[model samples]
Target: MAHWFHRNPIKATNAVTFDFGGQASTPLARNICSEARSARSNLLTIFADPTRDLTVLTDAAEKYLSILRGFVEPTVDPNSQRPPAQAPNSEGGEVESMEVSSSATGDSKLRNAIKFTWSNTLAEKHSSQHDFVFEQINILFNIALWHTKHAAALAGAKEDIAEDDAKEVHKCLRSAAGIFNYIDDKLTVKLFERTGDGTDLDPNIIKAYAQQCTAEAQEVTVARAIELKHASNLVSSLAFETGKQFKIADNSLKAVEENLVQKWRKYLQLKATFYLSYAHCYNGQTLLAQDKCGEAVRALKESKTQFEKADDLGRSYTSTKGAGKSAKPHEHAFFRRLLPLVRRNLEKVERENGFIYYQKVPEVVPELPSKATYGLASPVEFVMPSKHEDWTAETYNGFKISKPDAEKREKEKDDAPKPVKEVPVNQTDKESSNSSGCTIS
Candidate 1:
């Protein structure tokens, strides 16, 4: 479990007192700053061990986010750094994977009062910004990572995973995907600038992470179906969809620098291939059930070929250089147990074809399933936490913002075209749940 998932390191930052109160320090202002720091401290401490109780990890993350919202609430600026016309925060003309808000990205005096510094997930140099949105971005990113770690812990907690544990594992990965999507959708677009190489803020990296988490979550569901002895077609469909998700995730990394994520890519690639094998193996079972033993043999042969490819990729993944810790997915029974099952099915189908059905093996391979109908995983859409009550109107206007010089403000207006936002993902994802932000459906 320790090295099951690759995690970005916790960002290190120099502590800054959020003292926007200046000379007229109201009691509320001091309290706000104090509470903000305390919230941040608790979040950092909790992140140290993501394998703890699911509730504890999520609560800590959300608490910091809620209070931080008060600091980043929109403020008017004649010389806004963003474009006059707001655009979507999406790419490649796909549906907006995240909810894009029209609220102004804060250019407030308090926003620049405290600078936030965070190191890259790799050992690369860090990105530092005086903007409050920068802090929010880092917080949201780490929150997503914490959810992934929690999912990994649950999945590998024991060899024989309980039904409840599997459910939680599935839920956590979807939640993680939601957060990563949020960062890509809402927060990162608000940054004045991103000034670090190999930073986690890269859109391709975010998408890759999001896709991988979703695929991984679906993996748990597939295991559950198999464990419960679900119908062969159902399992095949689920496995096929899971592998497709992983492939999409792998393809997203094409634009990313290979040295930064070769191992990570290999891991995703093997998972993709491994799941394809699982799909074919189960598919062969389904074919055998229909007495199409010849077609079953063909599917099982393809399954065996995919399994071999995955095994070779597994060895390469272990040896490849990359950022983050190594993963031992091949060591898991969830992965190792598939080949024997495939072999057994192949043997049975070949014997049955010779004796019973007598159908000839076609010249071409049979088609693998296109997708899963019942258990295809999607991101558990994330909603940003509402501002804490401490950010009430009276408390909010208490601190006077230091006005920026007109010349400097004018100079800082970025002429860059705003990101075009895409359609929102489940804008209606409102359901009450105790697991984490959104209920696992």
Candidate 2:
């Protein structure tokens, strides 16, 4: 009966096209361009008149499409053959829907219906295949996260933004957060597949992918806490889960070399400790926001231990292997900035816990100049012409060399003579001034 109900293939191939505010051949290109237009219009409108005039759902949909594109279509250099050599790079897209046909006898009408249903038309294309592609998922997660960060940055930039407007932006963030978590959950399945009953696995590649996924999972949790303001208990629980995942990845590497394994474990432990510290700090902040002072203090105290361990590990690692080598400029700068802030947070928690403060609060340091703003504030260095170069006066017919019109107006104003008028005063005031030996000239 099931076989009798099967449908026959209606067509050998089907093409898909999208009309995204206009016609486009490819769905990806059409969707991207359409969203680009909407986003551009929204931003331009906002710039012209800073008001809550945006369609929030449309904005969220645009961001969602961005994440989808990042998953399905990666940026290409056009010249490079490889897809920018991202980790676990692969090609993936919506699978073409094809009806399964066999030599078995079945009703022709039913078969035709089945084939029509299975056809790779815009309305009937299979969607499950897209979810199986891991690279696309990761890219989508990252892009969604970038959108969340973008929204936060936008909120920070506009001082006069209304509460309702801010709430709209948060709605976008919430959607992004939800998608990110979904992908994270899906990635966990891939992690287990790689682990494969804890046996018969390559030491580096498979385990490395798992570790990468778990580490990114930790970051995703942190992002959730930051953007969603997840509950303190949930955030703390996630932090512990992240630590456990790191331990699992580390433990899997035991069959490898001792020194190598030890170093890997150390690095993993270092990361886990730092993430835990960040998580605890987040939990403390969450509690503090809810007016749970005691709980906040406790969470912050726990964070201090993890932070100290991370600091110690970082120092030890640098002193040993990085003895002669200087740290990267960004790393050096980040550590320099972060250390004091960590100290301050810890101090504040301690003070809240009724500890006496012997030392005065540290002076606030002004932010160092950013490299991006260097060109804005500093003049471009003028380079002298090379000795071998010939100097010539370049002239263009379209160019104007006369003084500007503003200068001419200023000259006319200066040349114009001024007219003066005499001031009138009350007779009594004038007489009093004269008696007091004072007079208006």
Per-residue accuracy of model 2 over 1-441 as CA lDDT, tens digit each: 000000011111111111222212244444443453454334323321212334543454444344333222223334543311111212453212111121122111111110100111111222111121332343333334333333433343333446564544445444444454444444435422332222112334234334434343344444445456556456555555555555665666666545323433455566567656765665665655665556666666666777778777655544332101221211332223434545676566557555532333223321111221111111112121121111111111111112123444334311211111112111111212222111111
Model 1, span 155-206: residue lDDT tens: 5555566778777878888998998999999888878796644677888888
lDDT of each: 0.71, 0.36
Clashes of each: 5, 4
Q: Estimate candidate 1's RMSD in Å.
A: 11.8
Q: Check candidate 2 and list the clashing pairs.
A: 6-111, 7-111, 8-111, 8-112
- For all predicted structures, in order, the TM-scores are 0.81, 0.32
For candidate 1, list the clashing residue pairs, or say none: 88-420, 88-421, 89-421, 96-422, 96-423
Off by over 4 Å in 2: 1-205, 224-235, 286-295, 319-342, 355-441
Clashes of 1: 5
The TM-score of candidate 2 is 0.32
Report how far off residue 17 is in candidate 1 (Å): 3.0
Q: Residue 272 error for model 2, in Å?
A: 0.7
For model 2, what is the error of residue 221's alpha carbon versus the real structure, in angstroms, after optimal superposition?
4.7
